[model samples]
Target: MVKRQAQHIQVDLQRQQLRLLSGDACIASYAISSARNGAGESRGSECTPRGLHSIRLKIGDGLPENSVFIGRRPTGEIYTPALAAADPGRDWILTRILWLSGLEPGRNRGGSVDSLRRFIYIHGTPDSEPMGQAASHGCIRMRNRELIELFERVRVGTVVEIRERC
Candidate 1:
């Protein structure tokens, strides 16, 4: 069993990178894509809510790559160029998903800006989405291979900090 610990996951939107940290030491860092509309704390705004949060639930462990999902349930079919072409407009959320919940109650937890209620996740995406660029509805999207590796390193209740570039 993976013991849950309070680790830090820092996202630098300006740098388009996600850094995993244990205390003051850096564990791993990878390129990431945040909300294209920029970051904020608002519901139905399709913007990435910024501030302190934690991994509420981690989903799709041991699942096959490219496995289609809607509402977090497997659709039992792997993603392909053909399937992608069929639905070019579809935003592919694949592989693993780290569902996030905001720590701040009034800021990002309850009400419209609730991160959990918004289904915000750090999930795998098709390679088509460029790394180091803002291009997601609200969640942070990472490449499948990178996400799988990341998923193995973290656990539920991991701390995630998102702040505007200073």
Candidate 2:
């Protein structure tokens, strides 16, 4: 019999990568899109907040890939190229979401620095969106299929550390 170490997530803002690690080994690595504004903790900064966080909620289980979400709820709309063309400026949140809450107070948590209040999430982006670079408004974005796979592996309350490097 084998015992598997519990998995945790790490987001490297500088590399624009996200790694799923179990113990000292990396179980999976994926290209990610972080924030265009870089790293910060203030509300409306549109920057990725850096600190210890956890998956406060896991959303979109059983939902189809490319399923659209707004305010953390399914919008009954599946993303399509035509749909994207119709509203090109829309901030797309698709497939799955891992809502994050900061563990460190006065940094990523509480008041203006509250990541949860900022609606920081690890969610899916359109296939047309480029990864491996910082482009998100604030959240961590991944490919739809990749996000779904990650969502299946991680549970609510999984530790997720976001930093300049993993």
Candidate 3:
């Protein structure tokens, strides 16, 4: 029997935390900022979808820390406090991206609820942004360094379980 990949990554929404696990043991923990609109399963809801998902794509290989991305492509810009002050309304996707694909059928997979279609990702944010709170439009937001570390550790198909509570 194959031990499922689901146990490797866990997101506790209630705590605004993400864990990197080895079997039942946690290898690392990172504070996260989830959807400010809370949890839901709909495209354009601006809320995090709760379910089993896989890291469908891991982007930003060989990029510098705080490298900026838009539309999943590097924009030839590195994030800086000055740049942020210039474009205060910009929803920054920095460092790396772990684009997610939902595993559940109707809940988060197909139709309007599809996470991939929704462009849901676990990506990095500017360090100035607050962590350990619900703040993002939809994506799971992490600090750049932590996200870089996680991006290095996990594979493309690693399963992630996002939960509403512990």
Candidate 4:
């Protein structure tokens, strides 16, 4: 049997959108929140790296919506407004997580610019948080339901290209 080509994701930093594409056609598009610090590839920069990347892992499968995750592990707490209120300063990683690794050697991968070392991800965010904006610390933030849907559709090794299209 021939292996199917993996679908690719295109993240437009300027538009704050993530599009899933198969071949040349767009399969899905979602409003997303990227880095408020903007795009870069340096460790400790807290900025989203711009380049070709791939899903290194997919987490939170079969988990309920609003499921809370900390350090890539489920925290056994579902996200609630009260919970959010209690930890207002916390950067919530909810529902699902799509961990990414940069494909480029120096631009976003390896050494000081390693995206995998940076722990970059496309993850779920609080419902109160707005999308289609640059608000995250460095990772891509999606709506909880939207992220679950996306997580179901994508697999590890899917290509993700993050770019700033002016």
Q: Model-by-model lDDT, in order?
A: 0.87, 0.92, 0.92, 0.91
lDDT of 2 by residue, 1-166 (tens): 2233377888899889999999878999999999999999999999999988989999999999999998999999999999999998887999999999998999998999999999999999999999998998999999999999999999888888888976
Off by over 4 Å in 4: 1-6
lDDT of 4 by residue, 39-85 (tens): 99999998999988889999999999999998999999999999998
Candidates' RMSD to native: 3.3, 3.7, 1.7, 2.9
TM-score of 4: 0.95
- Per-candidate TM-scores read 0.94, 0.95, 0.96, 0.95
Question: Of the candidates shown, which would achieve the greatest TM-score relative to the real structure?
Answer: 3
Instruction: Name the 10 consecutive residues with the lowest summed lDDT in model 1.
Output: 1-10
Under the 3 Å rule for N, CA and C atoms, how many clashes does model 3 have? 0
User: Could you give candidate 3's per-residue lDDT for residues 26-79 as a string of tens digits?
Assistant: 999999999999999999899999988999999998899999998999999999
Model 2 misplaced stretches (Cα beyond 4 Å): 1-5
Worst ten in a row by lDDT for model 2: 1-10
Q: Which candidate order results from sorting by TM-score in descending order?
A: 3, 2, 4, 1
At residue 82, candidate 4 shows an lDDT of 94
